[model samples]
Target: MRLSPGARERLTIFWMLFPTFLVIVGFYIYPTLYNLELSFTDITLLKLRKGGDWVGLANYWEFLRSSSFFDIALNTVFWLTAVSVTCRMILGLLFALLLNASFLKRMKLSTLARLILLVPWATPPVVAVIAWRWMFDPTHGAINSWLLSTGLISDPIAFVSNLSTVWPAINTIIVWNTTPLVAISLLAALQTVPQELNEAASIDGATKFQEFRFITLPYLIPTLSVLTLMSVIWTFNNFVYVWLATGAGPGTFTNVLATEVYLKAFVDLRIGYSAAIGVTMAVVMALFGALYFRLFGVGDMQEKVG
Candidate 1:
């Protein structure tokens, strides 16, 4: 049958998008639904071949009642807040500003600075973590040796093996690995700020701090908001640094939600419980994203992308 122009256009559009739609449904929607279903079951390694019976909210209840749950939650919060997101923002902005300086641009040092800054991010994560692990070793590590030689410490400090230092040690590694990407992103955003605005502010008797606070910072808010949200999500979900560096620590002192999920699934073989933990993480992130959008108004960050 012959179709009208609008009908033909609609059909063409649907056909164009059909493949992507199928891929999303198969890869994303199906797996999420299957995971939700598994979270309600008593699935384990032994029952891998044979399906387990549904246990309703038993898995969730078990996780909530688990002794380590509170500690894991607190560790996760600390990792996301103190270690990753906040540190990345503070350092990223500082480096971006320094790199964006007129003197750096005039001297052609900005390019070199950017390249050096990106080294940590460009290196493989596992390799970087391993190197950091060695550096944090109490004996024969450069850090400890340097501290001893400089009279900064009486003896070597066992960074990874001690509960008090383990989280900070691994977090330092995470910050080093992730901060470059944040700085590069912010640098691009900084470039978008009009020079005229800053000059105008300067001519109006504004101090450097006041000029940045009023002119530059206001322009960067949209970009910063989006980057902050993305950083939070990525940092919270990051399992590699924590898992590779200390394997969740000398004890459970540095164990966060991601590592706990990995341990529950692979090591303990509690598939259903792991699924519950994963679901909980997803729910928490979703709520955080919603609240972030409410506070930040979901500005047009796409335009700021370099």
Candidate 2:
């Protein structure tokens, strides 16, 4: 049978997308499904030889019944992810604005500031954590040393170990390491803002904030929204900063869901429980993605200027 032109085009498109769909299924879907399976089983370090028996949500119940779950979940959702993401967004936008300012470009300070921003992001995460960890050490950290010199702090604070300072210390590390990327992303978005709009706003007696609010911000909202969603997902799933910085130290003082998952699997040797936690994180993220798309369409409509 002979095919029509439209049918041929559709077939070609499907052929083009076939490999990508296969890759997505292989890497993402397969592992997710396997993890879902693992979550239901009584899998463990020794059970590698023999497949573990299915327990049908017993692992999930165990986590729920545990007293530490509530605190760890709260720490994960609120302080580690939400607060850190919020700070990154605010600080990123601030830095992007500073870097993108017209006057700052003339002064050449933007170049130096941008270089400084890139340094942290370009550094390896492990190295960055190590540096930050040393800085936060109570006995011999630059932070405490400076505090002592300035008479700002009577006693040196154990930032990574102490309960009161741990979360903030983690937040500082996260924001410091992550915010540069956000700022740089926003800076790129800022570059797309039309100069004519800003000029017109200024010509109309609009203030700087007004220029940003009306002219620049509208241009950036699409990028900002996508970046915000990405930041949340990345921060939510992040394992490195927490693990290396404090090892969930000072007796689970800075424990988040990610660390809990790791501790349950590697340290405590409970693979099934770890899979349950990971599955939970995936579910929460899936819900967030759906809500995000509902509030702001999957992608913004691009307006073409005549």
Write the residue-wise lDDT of candidate 1 on 52-125 in tens digits.
Answer: 78999999999999999998998898764556788889999999999898898899898899999999999899
Predict model 1's lDDT versus the native: 0.87
Q: Quick one: best TM-score, which candidate?
A: 1
lDDT of 2 by residue, 229-278 (tens): 89999998888999898898778877888999999988887898899999
Give every collision pair in model 2.
Answer: none
- Candidate 2: regions farther than 4 A off: 1-15, 299-306
Off by over 4 Å in 1: 299-306
CA-lDDT, candidates in order: 0.87, 0.89
Model 1 vs. true fold: TM: 0.95
> Which lDDT value does model 2 have at 190?
94
Q: How many residue pairs clash in each candidate?
A: 0, 0
